[model samples]
Structures are given as structure tokens and as C-alpha cells.
Target: MIASSWLLVAFPALGALILLVGGRRTDAWGHLLGCATVIASFGYAVAMFVSSSLAEATDVALYSWIPVDALQVEFGLRIDPLSMTFVLLITGVGALIHVYSIGYMADDAGRRRFFGYLNLFVASMLVLVLGNSFVTLYLGWEGVGLASYLLIGWYTGRPSAATAAKKAFLMNRVGDVGLALAIFLMFSEIGSTSYAAVFAGIGDLSPAVITAIALLLLLGACGKSGQFPLQAWLPDAMEGPTPVSALIHAATMVTAGVYLVARAAPIYNLTETGRLLVTIVGAFTLLLGAIIGCAYDDIKKVLAYSTVSQIGYMMLAVGLGPFGYALGIMHLLTHGFFKAGLFLGAGSVMHGMNDEVDMRKFGGLYKRMPITFATFGLGYLALIGFPFLSGFYSKDAIIEAAFGSEGWQGWVFGGAAMLGAGITGFYMTRLVLMTFFGKERWRELKSADGREFHPHESPPVMTVPMIVLAVGSVGAGFFFALGDRLVEFLAPSVGALSEAEHTALPHALIPWLTVGLSLFGALVAWLIFGRRDVPVERPQNVSPVTRAARNDLYGNALNEALVATPGLWTTRFAVYLDNKGVDGAVNGLAAALGGSSGRLRRLQTGFVRSYALSMLGGSFLIVAALLMVRFS
Candidate 1:
């Protein structure tokens, strides 16, 4: 079964090929085929997980991909506990998203193309996780970037969608450069890009080299996972269809960063500076996401920011070195369940509300869409770390681990995690209240077409998946955390927790402190939103802080000032140089030659007498010059 692991990626790759090349011939049942492919992959993943021996990692080499003197790279798959975990999450959640898209895109003329892109995304992400070497993983990394661009711009008719796609592609490329450089360094120093070889030789590398490699990998991770400085593209990605949001932002694409860090634990463990940087990045990004999440009116954008924050937690967990690698991944799995459900539930809301996304305009929808409300409510609870929920088990563990660190690092990271939890509760509770609990703002206001608003439940095709994911959101943590099974399963890949001397926080206080802050956040949100009326019209007069958050805390501004403006100016300068310097030099020389040739053309007068006279004059001048020289 491990030897045939290539089938996992092949299933969806074939689906994409058929749906795309078959064209209109596949439109009738293309979506169903897409769903089937992912489900089949999920089934295979489950079978492999149950039957494969967990004690040893299996490497399946499909072929030698690149061979040169002293350099060999194989197209292979690594079947281990870590890769298997991601395989199940990707295919399982992906299958659900595919099913949800059937109803979500049923009316669109390009639904077949959409399904094809979804399959391509699944195949690409599978390759990223299963690849046994960095080179192979980079192949999948580029594939995912391409697939995301296509999916995000699915409605190419919308300028915003097209722009969003371009932004995501370009930003991801920036991080990709770091990953590429890191691989080059590996080959330069270690003479191979294969994971086995690289890990085996990691000890021979200097601390400086290891730190450089770790940081480069983190750069790539930040770009994919929507961490600080590269996070602006994520919320705008909401311009894509909600199903795309559910699949990419919630379950698979964004989590790739966490997977990258966890997979590179051998490198991270070697340098304290590298590990501390990861912690700092994670700590900063989680707060950044949580703060921004509080100011969004768009339901999907809110969830998008929430995703940024949740992934930050994962980053923070894995950044804790051995203590948090398994914990981070554990949260990632649980997050996949609830976050995907939340995004799908948002889709269901948009489906019934005539595709409205503003939470300000949504109110009293519980009665109209009970299934969506129930499923979304469960996911919301899980996201907020409600007692015994999946997040409760996973998120709280991370918080406890943060505090378990020795000194000020623990205090700082633990504080950030705690504050982020509270802000998460506040913003998510705000979303729930505005969208479902208040008076129907729809009844008072008209839609874009000036028609009265009508809300209803989505078809069973969509709601059923939401319900299924909701169950996972409620139960997956308990299952994974019961015996620390997730930790034990991942120990082989990440190594067991270290017994290094550190000042550990009191374990009893962490969970209570986290939950108490969360409740306080929820209370504040209810007081501000639930007790008061939410205005349907966008509020103009607001505090400066709210305005800043609405503007993404000047994130885009900073990018524009530091990156976009500089880039634009550099491009303009290059164009100027090309026109005035390069082109000018060529054209100037051509003009001079043309002008001189034109004057010289007079010497070629068609008149024979004139030509003879010119020749005689030239001969006389030459004779006179020779005579003068001889006389001298």
C-alpha cells in the first residue's frame, strides 16, 4: 500500500485532467466526478493509515527525477505519520468542499471549470505533503500557487477577483524565492536535495547555515500561511467563491506553512535563534490577525482573518521546538474541521441571502436557516474554545505549552496567545450576533436590486457537509487528545519532547485563564452588539482604532509604501532607462549614420560630368598631399 502511495495524488490529478480536457463533454457530471476523486483519495488514505505499520517511515520512489554528477533527486513519496495526517485532512475536507461546491456553483455556467481547479488544488497540496524531497515539494508548491490563482479568479469577469488572484500569486512568489534559495543552499553545502540526505547531513552544517535555511523556510511558510507582512492577500482572497475560501483558507492551503515548519523540525531544533524567531513571528501574527478580525463587516473576510489567527496559533505551537510541534499539528487538524465548517456555513448564509456578505445586513436568520445556524453555531463554539470542544483540547494545550517555556519568552508568547484567544472570542461572537441573533435588518433595508430581502436554507447537498464537519469540530479534539495519541503518533517525525531545564508555569492555571479571558471577550461583544442595534448602513463616524483595523491596521499601506511603491518606482526607472538610454543610444547612432549617409549621397550624383569632376578633385588633393610630404 505504501509503494502505491502515488495513487493518492494521481486520483485527483486524473480528475482535473479529464474535467479540463474533456471540456463541455464533462459538464453534466464533472462536479460529481470531482467529488468522487477526492472521496476515493480519502478512502485510500484511511486504508493506508489503518494498515501501514506506524513504527517505521516508508519511502516510495517513483523514479529518479533529476540526476547529475554527485546530485540525485527522486520523485518519491514519504509515507509517515505526519504525511498521513495531512493526507487524511486534505482529501477528507476537500471531498466535503467539493460536494458543497456542487450546490454553491450549480447555477454558474463555468462550474465544470471550477471543479477542475478544485481537483488540481487537492492534487497539488497532496504532492506538497507527500513529497520525500524539497525539490519535489517545490514542484507541488508552484502547482498550488497556480491552482490558487485560477480558483481565486474563477469569476474573471470581476476585476476585484482578477486583482486578488494576481496579488496572491505575486506574494506567494516572493516567499517561493526564499524556499528556492534555501534548496539551493542545501544542494550547495550538503550536495543533495533529498529529505533523507539533507536531514542526515544537517549536523555537518554550521549554525549560521542552519539559521539561514530555517529562516528561508519560514519566509515561504509565512507567505503560504498568511503570516505577518505577507498576510494582506488573504482577506481580499474572499473575492473568490465561498467554497474556494472554505477549501483554501480553512483546511488545506493556509495550513501548508505549519506543515512546512513541522516537517523541518530537524533543522529548527538545531538553532535556538531560528526557533525563537518562529515563536516571535507566530506571536506577532496571531495578535495581528485577531485585532484585524474584529473590524470586518464582510462575513467571509472575518472568517478569513480568523483563519490567519488560528494558523498563527499553529505556528506558535510548532515554534515551541519539541514541546509544541505535535501540539501545533494537533490544533491544525482540529482547526481544519471547525474552520472549514465555519466557511461553508458562511457560504450557506450567502446562498440564501442572495449572495450578501455584510454581517450588518444579516439579522434574525436562525429561524430561516436552522441547519446552517446550528452547524455554524457549533463551529463558532469550537473556534472560541468552548469547553470540551475540539479547540478546547488543541488550542488550550498550545497555550499551556507557551507558558511552559522558561522565562520572559514564555510570558510574552503566552500573553499574546491568551490575548488572541480573548479577541477571537469577541470577534467571532460579534459575527454570530450580527448575522443571526438581532432583528432582521433585511426587513428594513432593500438588496442591491432594490427588492425586499428574502432568506432561506440552502439545499441538502450543502448543509449535509456542514453538519458532518460540525460533528468533527465537536469531537476530533477529544479523540486526538484523549491519550495524547496525536503526540505519540508524531513523535517519530518530530522527536520526543525535550527534558531541558525550564521554568514551567503551573498547569492548573492555564486552561482556566484561557477560558476565563474567552468568556470575558464574549461578554464584551454581546454587550456592544447583542444589546444594541447593528446599523445596516456602514458607519461613518468611528474611532481611529476601528478605522485602522478596517483598513487592515495599515498593512496594505505599509506594503504599498515599502514594497509596492518602491517596486513601481523601480519599474518606472527601468522603463525610463530603456527608453532614454538603451533605445536612445541605438536610435541616436542609427540617426547619425542615416544623416551622414544622406549628405554623402550627394557625392553619388547621377550626372557623369559631376561625378568625374569630384573624382578629379579627390585625385588632385591626394597628389598635392603626396608632393607636400616629399618636398618636406
Candidate 2:
């Protein structure tokens, strides 16, 4: 099974190829193939997990990909506990999303293409996790980026979708540059890019070089994981289909960053500054996401921001060094379960409500869609750290780990994590209240097409997956958190957690504090939104803070001012230079040559008399020049 690890990626890749090449011919059953491919991959991944757990990390090289004089890169897969864990998440959740998409996209003419894209996304993410070398990872990294762009812009008719796709693509590219440079630096300094070679050689590299590499990797992680400075694209990505949202946010694209950081633990472990920077980025981003999530009316956008916050917790966890690497991955796994469930549940709601996304237009839907309501409610509970749920186990573990850090770092990061939990509870509760609990706003509202609103339950194809995922959302944390089994299983890759000598908060009190804050947030939201008379119209008057959040806290504005505007101006300047300087010089020289040739053309007037006159004139001038030189 370990030797057959290549099949995990091959299954989806083959499916994508068949679906894409077959085109409309495959439309009748293409989605089935897509779901089957991912399901098969999940089965194989489970088998590999069982097999790999009993053995050490195994490297299976398929072939020599790039074999230069000094650089030897192989198309290889690493079968280990860490990679196995991700394989399960990507394929397992990805399979569910594919199944859900069958119903979600049933009416669309391009359903076949959508499934093909989903298969491609799964294949790319599989390659990202399974690759044994950075170069191979990068190949899958770019593939994931390309697939995301395609999926996000799946509705080509929607301008917002197109813009969102481009934004996601361009922003990811910015971070990809960092990853690419880090790989180059590894090849130059370490003389190898293989995990084995790099990890072994990393010890000899200077601290500065290690820090530089770590930071670069973090930048790439941020872009993919929706972390700070590069997170603006994620909420906009809500313009994509909800299934795309579930796949990217929950199981595949965003988790790539967390995986990258965790995989590069050896490098990060070498530099205190690098690790601290990771912690700082995580803390800041979690708060940013939580705060922004509070103000969103678009249901999917709210979930999108929640994803940003959840991923931040993962980042913060791994940033704690060995103490939190496994913990970070644990949270990532649980988050995949609940967040994907939440998004799918959101999809079900949309399917019922004539595709209305604004929470303001949704109310008292719990009766119309009980399964979605229950599933989404469970996921919401898990997300807000409801006790004994998946999030409570993983998220609270991260908070505890944060507090375990010595000195002010612990207090700051722990506090931020705690605050984010509270805010998460507040916003997610608000979403639930607005969408499912209040008066039935749909009765008085109309859908975007100006049709009468009629809310109903989605078919079992969608709700079933939501139920399965909701079960995971409720229990995955408990299973993974039991006796620290996840931590021990991941110990070989992430390193063992050293016992803490001091903590800002007591271990026994951490969960209580987290749960208490979460309840507080939930209560506050219930008071403000659940019990109050919710309004349907967009308010003309609101707090400045609410307005700021609606504007994405001016994140896009800053990006435009800092990156896009400057880039546009620079491009315009380059065009001007090309036109006036480069083109002008070339055209001016051509004109001068043309003018001089025009006079010279008279000498070649296709007549012997004309040639003789020109020759005689030239000869006289030569004679005059010679005489003057002789006299001087």
C-alpha cells in the first residue's frame, strides 16, 4: 500500500484528464467518475495510513524528474504519518464535496466541467502533500493555484467571479515568489532540495539563512492559508460557488499553507525570530478575521472570514514550535470537518432559498431545512469552541499551548487566541440567528431574479454529506484529542513537545476560560440579533467600525494603494518609456536613415549619367580633401 501511494494522486489526475478531454461526451456520468476517483483515493489513503503507521517514513521515487549535474530532483512521494494525515483529509473531505457538488450543480450545463475542475483540485492538493521535495511541492502548488482560479471564476458570466479569481491568482503569485525563492536558496546553500537532504544540511546553514528561508516559506503559507497581508482575496473568493468554497476553504487550498509550515518544521525550529514571527502573524490574522466576520451580511462571506480565523489558529498552533505543530495539524483536521460542513450547509440553505446569500434575506429557515439547520448548528457550535465538540478540543489545545509560552509572548498570543474564540462565537452565532432563528424574512423578500421566495430542503445528495461532516465536526476532536494520540502520531515529523515549566494560565482553567468566553460571545450575539427584531433593509446609518468591516477594513483599498495602484502606474510608465524612449529612438533612427537614403537614392537613379555625375562629385571632393591635407 505504501508503494502504491502514487495511485492516490493518479486516481484524481486520471479522472480530471478523462473528464476534460471527453468534454460534453462525459457529461452524463462525469460527476460520478469524479466522485469515484476521490473516493478511491480516500480508500487508498486510509490503507496507506494504516500501513505507514507501523513503519517509518518511506520515500517512493517514481522517476528522476530533473537530474542536472549538481541538482537531482525526483518525482517522489513521502509516505509518513504527516503526509498520510493530509491525504485522508484532502481525499476524504474532497470526496464529500464532489458528491455534494453533484446535487449543487445538477441544473448547470457545465456540471461536467465543474467536476473535472474538482478532480484536478484534489489531484493538485494530493501532489502538494505527498511530494517528497520542495520542487515537486511547488509543481502542485502552482497547479492548486491554477485550479482555484478556474473554480473561483467558474461562473464566467459574473464579473465579480472573474475579478475574484484574478485577485486570488495574483495575490497567491506574490506569495509563490517567496516559496520559489526559498527553494532557490535551498538549492544554492544546501545543495539539495530533497526533504532528507535539506533537513540534514539545514543544521550547517547560518541562522540568517535559515531565518530567511523560514520567513519566505511563511509568506507562501500566508498567501495560501489566508493569513495576514495576503488574506484580502479569501472573502472575495466567496464569489465562487459554495462547493468551491467548501473545497478550498475546508480541505485543500487554504490548508496547504499550514501543511507547508508544519512540513518545514526543521527550518523554523532553528530560528527563534522566525518562529516568533509566525506566532505574531497567526495572532494578528486570527483577530483580523474574527473582527471582520462580525460585520458580514453575506452568509458565505461570513464563513469565508471564519475560515481565515480558523486557519489563523492553525498557524498560531504550529508557530509555538514542537509544542504546537501536531496541535496545529489536529486543529486543521477538525477544522476541515466542521468548516466544510458549515459551507455545505450554507449551500443547502442557498439551494432552498432560491440562491439568496445575504443573511438579512434569510430568517426562520430552521423549519424549512431541518437537516441543514442541525448540521450548520453543530458546525457553528464546533467553530465557537462549544465544549466536547471538535473545535473545543483542537482550538482549546492551541489556546493552552499559546499560554504555555514563557513571558509576554504567551499572554499576548494566548489572549489574542482567546479573544478570537469569543469573536468567532459572536459572529457565527449572529449568522445562525440571522439565517435560521429569527422571523421568516424570506416571506417578505424576493430572490435576485425577482421571483417569489420559497424555501425548501435540499435533496439528500447534499444534506447527507453535510450530516456525515457534521458528525465529524462533533466527534473528530474527541477522537484525535484522546490521550494525545494525534500528538504522538505526529511526533516524528513535528518533533516531540517539551514539557512546559511555566504557563500563563493553568491547564485546568484554559478550557473553562475558552468555553466561558465563547458562551459570553454567543450570549451577546443572541441578545443583539436572535432576540431583537432583525431588519431586512441595509441600514443607511451604522457605526463607523461596522462600515469599515463592510469595506473589508479597507484591506482592498490598502492593496490598491500599496500594490495595485503602484503596479498600474509603473506599468503605464513602462509603456510610456517603451513608446517615447525605445520606440521613439528606433523610429527616429529609421527616419534619419530614410532621409539620408533619400538623398543617396538620387545617386542610384537607374541611369549611368546620374551615377557618373555622383561619382565625379565624390571624386572632386576627395581630390579637394587630399590637396588641403597636402597644403597643411
Candidate 3:
């Protein structure tokens, strides 16, 4: 079974091809095929994990991928702890999302096409994780971008969805440029793009060269993972189906950055400055997302911002070098379980509430949606790092690791991470109270289309996946952290866990202090939202901080001021140069040639006397010059 590990990608790719090619003729059961394909991939992954010996990394070669002068690349799979870990995650969570989409998109006319895109996405992500070389990984990376664009813009009738998809594709392209250049640089410097060659050759290169490569790779990771400056696209991606949100934002695409940084641990291990930049970006982004999340009333957008914040934590973890690689993966795994559950739970609420996404219009829904409320509550608790929950085990470990860093770095990053946790608690608690605990605000309100609100539970197909993920949200941390099992298991791939010798804060007090801050944040939320009369219409007059948070802390405004405005003028200037400089020069030369030629053509008038006169004048001038020369 391990020998045929390539089939893991082939299965979903085949499903996507068949469904898409089959078109409306296969509409009746395309979704089933999609779900089955992912399930099969997941089952095969489990089989390989159980049967194979991956103590050292196992390379299964498919074929020679690129064969050029002194450059060689192979299309292959690396069966190891790191790749296998992502394989299980992509296929497992992907399979659930497929099943849930059956209920969510059941009534839509494009369900078949949606499932096809879903399969395509899963297959692409699988290829990304399984590939052993940078070029191969990039092939899958572009495939993911393509699939994501299709899925996000599925609702072609909606202008917002179309714009969001374009925004996502263009922003990701900026990062893709960085990744492609990194690969080209690797081939130039190391003469190979294979992981083994690149990692082994890093020792021979100068520190500056290695740092350059790492930073470029980090740029690509940030683009894909929704890190700062590239983050605005992700929240807007909520225009797609809720299941798309759960899969891309929660389980797969956002975590790709952490995986990249972790996989490149060898290079980062050699560069202190490179690692510090990553930590700084992660720390700032987490706070950015957390601050913005507290002000959103749109249920899905709030969850979208929450995803941005959590992925920030993961980035910060991986940015800590050897100390946080395994820890980052650990948080990533636990976050997958809980965050995916939260998004799905949000979908369930929307399903019952006629697709209304505002928390302002939602109130006391727990009575009508008991299963959704319970599951969402578990996910919420886990996200906020409630003690003994999955988040507690994974997140607190990251906090501990951050605080243990040397000198002022520890306090700055650690304080940022802890503060992010508190803000997460406050906003997520606010979301819960506004959506599930306050007075039934829907009683006095109507849905977007003037439809009456009659909230109820979602179908079992959707609820079941939510339930399983909720269980993970509750217990996955304990399982992964038990005996440090996950760390030891992942050691062979990322490297052995490194503990810092110095401490900015007592290591023992980290978890306690972290939990205390979260509780305080949650307490404030309860006081503000839970106990008050829930207002269906949000108030206009608010503090400056609240206003800033509501405006995404002016992230878009910053981008517009910095990138969009400059880019627009630069484009116009280029156009002007093309017209007045390049084209103008060419047109002037043409005009001059035409004028000179026209004047010369007048001498060729179709009259014998004119030709004779011109020839006689030329001959007389030549004769006079020759006579003068002879006389001299």
C-alpha cells in the first residue's frame, strides 16, 4: 500500500476530472463521488501510516520530472512524519467538508460543479504536501490557487464573490512570484530543487545567500497563510459557501505557511535575523486579527478574522526556530479540529436562519439549535484556551515556548501572544453571547429578503461532521500533548525539540497567567454582551478604538494608500511612456522617412523631359567636380 502512495493524489484528481467532464449528466451523484474519493485517500493514508516504517524519511520516486543541463528534479513523494501528518489532515478534514457540503449545497443548481472544485482542491493540496521537490510543490501550489479561485467565485451572480476571488488570486500571485524565484535561485546556487539537495547544500552557501532564500520562501508562505498585509483577502473570501470557509481557512490553506517555515528549519536554524522577522510579522498579525474580530457583527466575517488571528499564533510558533517547529505543527493540528468545527457550526446557524450572517439578528438560538450550540460552544472554549481543552494543551505550550526565548525578544513576542489570547477570548465570547445566549432578537427582525425567521437544527449530514470536529475540539490537545507523543513522533521530520535556556517569565507561571488573562477577557465580554439587552441595530456612536477595530484597523486603507495608489499611477506612467517615448520615436522616424521619400519621388515624375532634366543637372554637377579635381 505504501508503494502505491501516489494514488493518494490520483484518487481525488480522477474524481474531479470525471465529475467535471461528466458535467450535468453526472449531477445526480457527483457529490457522493467527491466524498468517496477523499475518504479513500484518507483510508490509504492511515494504512500507509500503520504499515510503513518511516523512521528515517522515505522517498518514493515517481519519475524524472525536470532534466536539463546539470539540473535534475524528480516527481516524488516523501513518506515521513511531516508529509504524512499533513496528508492525514488534508484528506480527513477534506472528506468531512465534502460530506457536509452535500447538505449545505443540496438545493443549489451548481452542486455538481461545486463538488468537482472541492475534489480538485483536495487533490491539489495533497500534491503540495506529498511532493518531495520545490518545483513539484510549486506545481501543486498553483493548482491550489486555481481551485480556490473557482470555489470562491462559485456564485457568479454575486459581484462581491467575483471581486473577492480576483483579490485572492492576485494577492496569492504576489507570493507565488516569491516562491518561484526562490526555486530558481536554488537551482542557480545549489543546482537542484530537491528537498534533500537543498537542505544538505545550505551548509555550503554563505549565510547571506541562505537568508535571502529563507526570506523569499517566507514571503510565499505569508501570502498563502494570510499573514499581515496579505490578510485582507481572507476575510472577504467568506463570500463563498460556508463549507469552503471551513476547509480552506480552517483545515488546509492557511496552515501551509507554518508547514513551509517548519520544513525549512535547517535554513532558518542558521539565520537569526530571518527568524526574528517571521516572529515579528506573526506577533503583529495575531493582534491585528484579534482587534478586528472584536468589532464585527457579521458572524462569518468574525470567524474569518478569528482564523487570521489563530494562524498568526501558528506563524509565531514556527518562527521561533527549533523551539517552536513541532509546537507550531501541534497547534496547527488542534486548531484544524476546533476552527473547522467553529466554521461549520456557524454554517449550521446560517442554515437554520435563512442564510442571515449577522449576530445582531441572531439571539437565543441555542434553544432551537441544541446540537449546533453545544458543538460551537466546545469549539469556542477550545479556541479561547479554556483549561484542559485541546487549545489549552497546544496553545499554552506555544505561549510557554515564546516566553522562554532569550532577552527582550521573549517579553515582546510573549506579551503579544498572551494579549492575542485575551482578545480572542473576548471576541469569541462576544460572538457566542450575541449569537446564542441573549434575548431572541429575531423576534423583532426579518431575514435579508423579508422572510420570517424560524430557526431550527441543521440536517444530520451537516451536524454529524460538526459533532466529530467538536469532539476533536474538546480532546485533540490532550491526545497530542499526552506524553509529548506528537513532538517525539514529529522529531525525525522537523528536528528534535529545542528548549531555551533563559526565561523572560517563569515557565511554570506562563500557562496560569495565560489562562487568567483569557478568563478576564471572557468575563468582560459576558458583562458587556451576555447581560445586556441585545441590540439588533448596532449603535453608531462608539469609541475611537471600537471604530478602528470595526474598520479592520485601516488595513485596507493602508494597502490602498501604499500599494493601490502607487501602482495605479505607475501603470499610467508606463502607458504614457509607451505612447510618447517608444511609440513617438518610431512614429517620428516613419514620418521623416515618408516625407524624404515623397520629396525624392517628385524627381521621378512620369515625364521624359523631367527625367532628362534631372539626369542632365546631376551629370553637369559631376562633370564640373571632376574638371576642378583634374585642374588642381
lDDT of 3 by residue, 299-335 (tens): 9999999989988888888888876888889999999
Query: In candidate 2, which residue pairs clash?
Result: none
Give stretches of model 2 more than 4 Å off: 500-505, 600-632
Model 2, 1-632: lDDT tens per residue? 77777999999999999999997889999999999999999998887676555346789999999999999999999887898889999999999999999999999998888999999999999999999999999999999999999999999999999999999999999999999999999999999999999999999999999999999999999999989999999998988899999999998999999999999999998999989999999999999999999998999999999999899999999998877899899999999999999999999998988888989999999999999999999999999989999999999989998988889988999999999989998999999999999899889877667877789999999999999999999999999999888988888787876554223335668878999999999999999998787999888699999999888888889999999999999999999999999999999999999999999877666988977887899999999999999999
Per-model TM-score on C-alpha atoms: 0.97, 0.96, 0.95
lDDT at residue 321 of model 3 (Cα atoms): 80
lDDT of each: 0.93, 0.92, 0.91
Q: Model 2, residue 360: what's the lDDT? A: 93
Best by TM-score: 1
Model 3 root mean square deviation, Cα atoms: 2.2
Kindly list the per-residue Cα lDDT of model 1 for residues 1-632, writing each as its tens digit: 88889999999999999999997989999999999999999999999999989676778999998888777998999998999999999999999999999999999999998999999999999999999999999999999999999989888899999999999999998899989999999999999998899999999999999999999999999999999879999888899999999999877889999999999999999988888988998999999999999998999999999999999999999998887899999999999999999999999999999888999999999999999999999999999999999999999889989988778988999999999999999999999999999888988887787766789999999999999999999999999998778888898888876445123434667977899999899999999999989988889898999999999999999999999999999999999999999999999999999999999987886999998898899999999999999999
RMSD of each: 1.5, 2.0, 2.2
By summed lDDT, the worst window of 10 consecutive residues in model 2 runs over 497-506
**Given candidate 1, what's the lDDT at residue 601?**
89
